[model samples]
Target: MRSSDVSAGLAEGAGQAAAERIRDAAILRYGRDGFAVGLRAVGADAGVTAGLVLHYFGSKEGLRRACDAYVLSVIRSEKLKATTGGPAVVIAQLAEVEEYAPIALYALRSLQAGGELAIEFMEQMCADALEYLEAGVAQGLLKPSRDPVARARYLATQAMGSLLLWVSLHPEFHEIDDFRKELRQLWDEIALPALELFSEGLFVDRTMLDEYLMYVCDPPAGDAKP
Candidate 1:
């Protein structure tokens, strides 16, 4: 390759690196500050000029969209890794859960913002959940679902809803100045109960499920109950 080509390639690589740095910084900042955070703050956090942030992302909204996509991709990758990597990997990840604080906070902020973008992000999450959940079923780590897609969507919605509700109920959670600390505290509180419910289940028997399926879902022919 020509010297100019090599220099241009190097410059392009540097620009991409800078853009990723900015995006990551924005993720942490927005996670802490929410959607109302200014671009200058993001740039400062990223160690770049506000003009550079705009140059790469065009506007605050554009930067937010980029953050959303990046956060989603990171979550999808991590979840897939956990699903496929077996119990040891899952345990190891849980040991280092602090690493996920920024991503989790960003996701919570996105959902809390509430708009078209949030809805789109959530739909993508559900789709990704379905993919990984199917992988878990294939690996025998998770039970097979009669309606896998709906199950995946339901699980995603339930998880998000539960977290949001917890945060809402404990307004002091938002008073924490450090995002990582806040996430750690939240995880410490919820992990045991969530695991118990997921593993042991809430119901003692299948009677409720049987009735729901037989009566509510697909009732027997000529059953005049309705």
Candidate 2:
């Protein structure tokens, strides 16, 4: 390669490295301090000047969007292993990288903050779920829904709600002394079941749903006796 090309490649590599460092720092601080975590603090944590962070991300909102994208990408990579293991697996895996727990918490807090960032993140999540559900239907791995878009929304909402609830109740789980153990327990009791409900559903005899609805519309003669 030409010397100029080699120089350009080196510069690109260094830029990427700096960006990753800033991202990691932002994740740690934001996870611990929420979206309001100072960019200067994140830069300090990354061992980079605040100007470098600003140059890479442009603004705090830009950094937050980057974090959301990174977190979602990580979750997507894990989801590729199993159809319904994304949220539960991601939550459980965060225990392995304790620093990431706060990043997950930051995501939960963003939902309540209700800004453009939250909307964009949620829209991306729902869009991804819809794509996955549609593909599953084509591959015969999942039952086809009459309204796949609505089904995606419901599934995504359930997953997000379960994560939010788990993070919000962290204090109770923390009291268990072994948080990883308690988190796993909570996952089994809450997240796993919620995912199962989305994947397998609750009813053993789905045909009974029609029967029950019919009965609701017109009662049996045996039920007429007062």
Candidate 3:
């Protein structure tokens, strides 16, 4: 390659490296301090000049968008691979990304703070989750609910709540693996029971439940019971 081309390639590599460093710093600090941390502080944490940070991300909000995109992409990729296992697969995959706990915490903090970006991010996640649920149904891995959209919303809300609770309890544990093990155990204790209930269903006897349903609620308008 030409010397100029080599120089360009080196510059591009260095720029990408710097951008990633800045993002990591932002994620770590944001997890601890939320959006209150300035871009200059993130630049300082990354050992890069504030000007370079701006050059790479345009603004603090832009950097946050980048961070959100990165974290969400990682999660969605794992979720896609876990589709066959349903929500349990997704939970298992969460344990694999423990190294990115800072990013996970940052997402939770962002969601809790609530704004246009937070709402948009959450909306995107719920939509992605719904798509995953639809795929699971199609693959015969998940049972179809009478209202898939509502089911998706409930699952998304619970998943997010679980992450927040995990992060809240994380500092009490000394070791990462211990925390992960505990989180997995907790998931089993909680999520598994919920899944079992869903699979086993709510009513003990379908005939009795159907009788109650027909007696307590009106039938179809044109097909009301005589």
Candidate 4:
């Protein structure tokens, strides 16, 4: 290639790198603060000017969309890792929970913000969950679900709902200076019960489920309620 072409290619690569840095910094900022955080603050965190940020992302909303996409991709990658790697890999990942703090906090902030973006994030999460859950089943790490899509949605809803409830119950969690510490505390408190319930299950038998399926979900022709 000519000298000019080489310089243009190098500049394009640098611009892509800078844009990625800005996107990552925005994730950390939005996770720590909220969506209301300004582009200037994100630029400061990214070591770039706000004008550069705008040039790269077009607007704050564009930057946010990029962050959301990146966060969702991270979530999918990590969950797929767990699905394919099994319990040992999961335990190892948990040991390095600090690495995930920013992503987790960003997701929490999105949910806490509560709007169209939050709903979109959640729907994407559910879709990703369904993908990984199917992978788990294929790998024999998880049982096949009768309604895999519904099961994925239910799992996502249950996990997020429980997290929101836990955060609401412990307001001091938000006051913690270290986001990683807060996440660790939350994991430490819930890990045992959540694992036990998921592994051993809550019900001693399937009587309740059987009855529900029989009476509620698919009642006899004449047994329908008014």
Report lDDT (CA) for all predictions.
Answer: 0.84, 0.70, 0.76, 0.85
Output the lDDT of residue 9, model 1.
Answer: 99
Q: Return the TM-score for each candidate structure.
A: 0.89, 0.75, 0.74, 0.90
The sequence of per-residue lDDT tens digits that candidate 4 reaches over residues 82-173 is 88789998898888877788888788888999988889999999999999988988888877765788889999889888877766676664
**Candidate 2 Cα deviation (angstroms), residue 172:** 7.4
Among the numbered candidates, top TM-score falls to 4
lDDT of 3 at 185: 65
Top candidate (lDDT): 4
lDDT of 3 by residue, 1-226 (tens): 8999999999999999999999988877786777988888999999998898999999989999998888777666666567767666666665565455565667787897789999988887788888877787778877776557777888888889887777676666544355446655666567667767867877776788458657966543332221
1-226: candidate 1 lDDT, tens digit per residue: 9999999999999999999999999988887778898989999989999999999999988998999999989988888888778878877877787888788878988999999999999999999999998898788777777777888899889888876776677555442255567666777787788779978999999789777877776544442221
List candidate 1 stretches off by more than 4 Å.
171-177, 217-226
Return the lDDT, model 1, position 85: 81
Better of 2 and 4 by TM-score: 4
